[model samples]
Target: MTLKTCSRADGHVRAFPLARTLPLLGALTLLPLTSQAADQATGEDAAGQTASYETTEQAPRSEYLSDWYNQNVTIIGSKNIRFGPQQVDDIYLEYEFFGRKGPWDLYGYIDLPKFFGTGNGADSGIFDNGSPLFAELEPRLSLNKASDMDLSLGPIKEWYLAVDYIFDWGHNSNNRQSTLYAGIGTDIDTHTPVGLSFNFYKRYQGDNYGAANEDQWDGYRAQAKYFLPLATFGNGAKLDYVGFTNYDFGSDLGDRDASRTNESVVATNVLLYSFTHLRFMAVARYFHNGGQWNDDAELNFGDGPFHVRSTGWGYYLGVGWQF
Candidate 1:
């Protein structure tokens, strides 16, 4: 009586030992003892004496999970030389984690850039002065424009405590502003995964004119992002729709009482290709607010207390690669 074995993607199964088979009368009883030992070693105590394996075993799953969460980091930076409504040459850095056994995840990004002229002002060609230099030194300066950094540490498994800060300083008076934000949110798994985030922050705006009016803005912002995957492309092509709103509750300028509401919808799509990395995204934004400053007040655009109507829009096309 020789024992035979069959191996599949999961664990192997062996024919009952010749001596043990007679007691069971060839009933084909599973190797209960061996299965239980394997289960306990793998932390699957609920498996009891049953033999089972995951439908899809993703190669050294534990190692992959750890590397995916701890070592997987991405950095992206880009620059635009063409004169545009915003005249921005920016850099962005982002980090993501996908395998944490939690209802929520910690994620954040940093955006840094310089704008030569106001969003509404006529092009001073100042953004153009460095066009040639920027284009020539694209590889160098494009890596230096702006920085945005965010991190979320999970304390309650599925719930995460998030802290984010953004610093912008480039062109236009070389102004500097920083935001210190903290929030909590959850990741609810549904047909379309949903993420809800809330953040409150203190904003400090630095003035170039040596004015005593250097201001502080305290505000709260909330956002939700929904994942939409295309059935045609399966998981290869993914879409995300996000909505966000924000309001300011405090400002430093005296006699300046201000409140703002922002609503925005954005659609982002990932393109699958082997040769080139591509992504397309569109954004529609609406803003409305009043109080403290008149519609035309010379409120420092970067400072709080300024009202913005639903009259501005921003969109971008990006291509990136991972090494």
Candidate 2:
């Protein structure tokens, strides 16, 4: 029998043996498996591997339940950014990774933002020649997956406990700050995908990892994310939207003289268009960083946290490849 093969954009090929025996739907169905296993970069269709394939001969389920999570990575850039409470003019770039290993769901990202200025202040041109870098790591342990048990409670598909850690430095401050988070999260996979989580965080600042903090705080933060799909363009192009928000209610500040509540709200909306593995995204963001930990005394950052406004909005446009 002659084999028929088709190539995906990522240079992965799928072979079909005896095309006459395979219906078009079956053949198309097989396309994604090979395509996903081939690229492994751009995220796969969440529901693509769930269907069963059948013919004169029986076919197995398209996907096998695995002990590991699928690996996905996305890199993005945002330019002409303007955002608030602490109005900032900067260019931002971020690289995010998501994956599962054993019973752990690992996710995190690195960010670098080049600040041009605050746009309206004495320090308006302060960051004209510099950029600050940030990095985060989160590895969550899923009780249901680890124990091979279905721990669904009502509409929740899966529940896990996670620790999130973040570090930031570089913009001329030799000192860095590390924030640690502990939380529980649930995934709701209804018609739309949603994530909900609550976490407690504490931050430490200094040149060393365990250095004493000039300013520290403990707080609880709640976060939510929703995925919305728009229209599908011809030939597999798609428009998608995601809205994410986080609210922090700080309980205490280590600095005895600090009076601000350290409470804050941050929200972002991202609209993205994807063709093959390439994506173009537009982002709008709102920030109200009510908690400022005296930057001048702690990090010697000048006006401390007093320089930033109480609220502001920002925008960005960027292109990226998912791999």
Candidate 3:
């Protein structure tokens, strides 16, 4: 018996202008780091209320970020989207449940995806046509207040240890990769409606796409998220920005002599508007050196030079309802 592997004879490659914009982008990205350093130098504590900023966890009145719905469900749909070389219309739905009990905080969410179509020649099926019924369920546990560990310093208002587990099941299980991760998270005082967090993660991967080389992929990941308010609409309506940046230091694969191995970054900046229980979002996304899934799809199972530029940009608009 033999397997018919798809050849990259028609694969496309695009020029990455990353080198030209990196310097400017680098400066903007350093803002949080610089602020964190300055706060530490001045011994700024998140204890008392400052003139400009307050924290979600330490405020006397308990101000929850976004609306104060402890347990909520969100369903969003995106269409007429441009993602890298593909034009895709997909539907996304998610549910989040959060709670605090004793000394521990638990939060979890389930994400579901349904792909309708793709414009490019890429496969459209959940397994082939570039679209997959990709879905994930992740639960996170935080232990900071429970352990009575004073992990705060300067603008580093609070620090906690977290353990997360992600269960993936979708399509022909092409996206079936579960992950277990442990890491430390920190919160800092970045005035305005913008909040900042920097965290590090050590991840262990599970089998996927009939590949069981999960052991060869234990590595570190650095992640950050920001929340920025843009403007106010009528009544309780407001416009805001929230997104994250991530870099994964994936383990070496195949021969080490390959030109470009693994090292990828994903960043998204979103503009969101809220009106009552409904919200709308428009986001610009950037991907560098491809992410794990792209890497997996581009892997050459046969003999040939594998070339796929993982850098690209995309745009998406979505609407969601909260209950």
Alpha-carbon TM-score of each model against the true structure: 0.42, 0.61, 0.62
Q: Residues 193-286, candidate 3, lDDT per residue (tens digit)? A: 5678666777766643433335444666776766665655334355555666767776553234243334556666666554433545555556
- How many clashes in candidate 1? 5
Off by over 4 Å in 3: 1-89, 96-108, 115-133, 136-142, 171-175, 210-213, 254-260, 293-309
- What ordering of candidates by lDDT runs from best to worst? 3, 2, 1
lDDT of 1 by residue, 254-300 (tens): 23332221211211112111111122222222222221122232344
Please give the lDDT score for candidate 3: 0.39
- Looking at model 1, which ten-residue stretch has the lowest summed lDDT? 132-141
Each prediction's Cα RMSD? 21.9, 14.1, 11.6
What is the lDDT, from 0 to 100, of the residue 75 in candidate 1? 23
lDDT of each: 0.23, 0.39, 0.39
Residue-by-residue lDDT tens digits, candidate 2, 1-323: 00001000000011110001110111111111111122112233443331112212243222332222322223222222222223333333345445455677665554443332222232121145332555556666888887899998877777888665655553444334455657777766574333233333333323322223334545666666555556554344566555556576654443434423355565656665555444555555554542332222222236664543435554444554444
Output the number of the TM-score-best candidate. 3
Clashing pairs in 1: 103-158, 110-148, 111-148, 112-146, 112-147
